[model samples]
Target chain A: MNQVIETILQHRSIRKFEDRPLSDEQIRTIVECAQAASTSSFIQAYSIIGVKNKETKRKLAELAGNQSYVEHNGHFFVFCADLHRHEIVGEMENVDLSSALESTEKFMVALIDTALAAQNAVIAAESMGLGVCYIGGLRNNLPEVCELLKVPKRVIPLFGIAVGYPAQNPDKKPRLPFHHVYHEETYQQDRSELENQLKQYNETISSYYKNRTNGERQDTWTRQMANMLSKQVRMYMKEFVESKGFNLK
Target chain B: MNQVIETILQHRSIRKFEDRPLSDEQIRTIVECAQAASTSSFIQAYSIIGVKNKETKRKLAELAGNQSYVEHNGHFFVFCADLHRHEIVGEMENVDLSSALESTEKFMVALIDTALAAQNAVIAAESMGLGVCYIGGLRNNLPEVCELLKVPKRVIPLFGIAVGYPAQNPDKKPRLPFHHVYHEETYQQDRSELENQLKQYNETISSYYKNRTNGERQDTWTRQMANMLSKQVRMYMKEFVESKGFNLK
Candidate 1:
């Protein structure tokens, strides 16, 4: 296997991190690498706010479902899906930016662009001997996150990422068999074969969680998914995004 | 900078690829790395279909706005926002999968999961001396792509990625200023400062494009955006997503 492939295959979400802070140079390099990722037609509709302030991190940690790792992580960044930049450009050009910011097309572009850039940052951080974890819980309080971050009308909080040196080596979580996800040229939903694959995957996941949690409830992947889906944790997202000027219409 | 960071920072989309095919082992490794990326609550709501058949590749190229790179790239992978697996699990469990597959939250999860995994694959491939380019034009014919690929309900085509050794050195595309995207704790629409930053960026982009295209009409960043937005490209995406059973309610 290629060395990069080897490194990526061994990836595990590092929640526990050493207390050491990332150097400014390191931060710059990671951000630059992130900026280098391809954007839709070079719009680059995303931004990362590096959070080093202890008080602010605590506040953000509270906002993100009280994730302690976020408060104490060596480096924290919040990736925003921003259309505000283009809105300003539109103003200077004496054009209406309202349609540009509100369109669903623009929202998709911003979200995808943000994800691509953040992913690059994650890889770059890992390559530089750093540990990282994405905090999707940041969306737990979307409006509050925006208010606290002082985000403008056309920019919304997408997700937060925490980066640092590893303090512990967590076990790699099991995934569904490749066949379960990979299809041919088109989408195929052959459940029986996938179910057969899932039987093994469920066992793998069950054992993984069991061993990791020291014999906690041996939950299969499906059961865990069911538990998650039953909750309406992100129900406000649509309205929130709309309020933030993303017209999904 | 770390070698991985260097690779990422120096990254460029390679439209032209060498004729050499990727080895099966290399493919396996890249896919494994992709799977290692974070999935929302580990639902892993995405899949990739590797295309090796020339006929299928040619058809896909035609479907994706006649991009020749799709047919000639060393490896082509179509990433799907997949909820089909969950639909099957629901059928077997006699549970409602409609809610899981149709919600906006679920769609966002699948999209983010697919993108994160694909980005990982890109990084890993690059580390192994491969080049990559994302094909957002794949969405140009969503239903056709779904029909041709035999995509099941609840699985939407998110994007395509082409990976292989580079046959040509493409120029690094310039990005908007960091401040244009990144904001502090809150969203700010302070236009004056942002516009100033954008002027510098516009100049940078104008010069870069001019040098690359050998004096081809040097369109400013804002002009390019206005031109793209003025045209209709993704106008049908909402309806297409709805047709795929993503009510996004």
Candidate 2:
């Protein structure tokens, strides 16, 4: 494999980071890489907020479900789905765009744009010999995060990336089997066939957790998904996104 | 910049491609890189469908708003946000996961997961000297796409990627100014300041289009956005996603 694919294949989230801040050059390069990602229809419906203030990072870490790495990272960058700029374009051009901006289509575009950019940023950080973790936990208290980050309407803070030098190397978490996630021509609809693949994967995952925790935990992927999916977590996301003036119609 | 960062920064959507099919090894490596992307909470809520049949590609190209490259590319991959696997897991475990699976939170997770994986696939393709374009036009007719692809419930085909050897090398479209897209800790709130930045970018984009089209086309970014956003497009996306058992809550 080439160096680029090797970097991608070797990726594992790093939670424990060394107590060192990224240089200005590193931060610039990462964000620039983010900007280089493809934007849908060239709308560029996203923004990046670099959080450098320690107090702000501390509060953000707390707000992101008490994820300590968020506060201790070399730098924290929040990726936001931002159509606020589009709204400004509307005002400047004296055209009403509220209907289009509020459409679920645009909201999906913004979310996809933000995500593509964030992944590039993560890859850039990793290539620089830095480690990164996506802080989806930030969505746990998004309204408060909006207030803390001074995020405006038509702009939703989707997630953050905690980037820093690595303090510890974690084992790569095994992914689903190739055939299980990849289909040719059409989706594999046979339940029995799918279950067979998953059953084998369930063992692989259970053994992974068991070995990682020294037999303390032996959870299968299915159980983890079942437990996580059975709960009504973040039930307010719809209302929250609507509050930011997205997905109105 | 390193090779990976360089690969990212040089990205541009390729519409014209040579009539060459990718080898089996190339497809496998690209999909493997996609699976290596970081999934939210290890949910792995996505799937990649490789379309090899000529008739299927032709129909998909028509379905995706007549994007000819989609049918002409070396390979076509549809990235889907899939929670159907979790639904199966729930059945196997005899636990109800309808609440979580139907929630907007899970839908967003699936969407994010799909985008991250797609970006990785695109990057991998680019690194291997292949050109790729994201086919958001697939959303033009979601129901038809679902029917044609035989996509089941709890799975939404978000977008497709057309990867092939490049036949054209177009100039990179200029993005928004760095400061305008990147904020320190909070979103910049001054309209005048923001407008000023946009106005300068407008000139840059207008010039790019003018040069590219030999003065036949010269549209500012703001005008382009205003025109696009003034009209309602893809009004059926929300309902379409809901019908697919996503964003139901």
Which portions of model 1 show Cα errors greater than 4 Å? B184-188
Tens digit per residue, CA lDDT, model 1, A1-249: 655666677788999889999998888777888898878777788878888889889999998888889998888999888887777777777776566567766777788888889898888888888999999989889888877777878787788899999999988887788767666555555656778887778888888888888998688887777666666667777777888888466
Cα distance off (Å), candidate 2, residue B92: 1.0
C-alpha TM-score for every candidate = 0.95, 0.99
Q: Grade the docking of candidate 2.
A: high
- Per residue, candidate 1 scores C-alpha lDDT tens digits across B88-169 of 6676566776765777677777777888898888888888899998998888888888877888778887888989889999
Q: Let me know the TM-score candidate 2 reaches against the reference structure.
A: 0.99
**Candidate 1 lDDT for residue A213:** 84
